[model samples]
Target: MSSRKSILEAIKAIPREEKPLPDLPDFGISGELEEGFTQSILGNKGEVLEKSVFENWLATQDFSKILSLTESYRNLSTIELPKDPHELSTLDLAILEGQFGVAENGAIWLDDSQLFLRAIPFITEHLVIVLDRKNLVPTLHQAYQRIGDAHSGFGLFVAGPSKTADIEQSLVIGAHGAKSLRVVWK
Candidate 1:
């Protein structure tokens, strides 16, 4: 079979809309958001945690080694992102300051300005997203209010770690994308 067919088969196999939204209308999503929204996409538990608790949790885990493995990781502090996405390394992760959030799927719409590597999200062993307490949204429908026609540049709404359950109905996380996602709210 062709690679495209194989990929399509995999995506189709995933259980569609298996997860449901929570009952509360407030849902703890933020309201003062405009362009580039992406929060409500995550899920209920996404909002239940305190920022302090989340930050404290990060201090407990070890990401130093993972950072060292990437060929261009150390150079990011001094390097500027190339305008082209093709220039990004497969293991680079960009910590961007999100402009707004998407409520429908708990995603954050970040501008390329804060990114160090253009394709950082697609080619990284780990991803760490940091957000301020001020930016959060309720639903994907609400997120659409922020996107304008000039979405000419690149953007993405990421939720949790990358995952796939393509084999034997198994539930696996971090298959093709980063093996882990570290979210910090301050």
Candidate 2:
């Protein structure tokens, strides 16, 4: 017998044991989901806002170059979605819809279907994600249960603004992506 065949036969002859999956601890913070989400987002250097607060904040800004994909804020949209992802490098602000938010880590789920250009959120100077308050989950386990395996080839859990501490342990926000992140809960 060839050496490779002999090795394969020996490997196949070995007994294997099946192990049960470990049970995840119940964080049990569902009742405080909103507070947990707010604290987590604040820890990640992101801001959480109510609809009225966000609207009031928006009113003070210059909307000349804002790009909004959500239907509710279409009136404030100034630029069209770029055909090329590279063209998004100059975006000042981008407002997109998030499918859900996780309270454990303050992450918002975004899939390819929700993003006109995959780079819009990352390329913009500021990113605003609009998510429904009812869609908040207490943990990543529950968040995954909600998403399942059905996705449009691409998905991401964005936690906050891009940051890097690579250089001399110095923190840098917006090092490679949006400088700030604001979550608008409706």
Q: lDDT winner among the candidates? A: 2
Model 2 lDDT tens row, 35-142? 999898999999999989999999988756788999888777887887988877678889999999999999999998789678887889999999988989998999
Runs with alpha carbons beyond 4 Å of true place in candidate 1: 1-55, 65-94
Instruction: Report, for all candidates in order, the number of backbone clashes.
Output: 19, 0
Q: After superposition, how far is residue 51 of candidate 2 from its true place, in Å?
A: 1.5
Residue 113 error, candidate 2, Å: 1.9
Off by over 4 Å in 2: none
Worst 10 residues of 1 by lDDT: 64-73
The C-alpha lDDT values of all candidates are 0.53, 0.89
What's the TM for model 2? 0.93
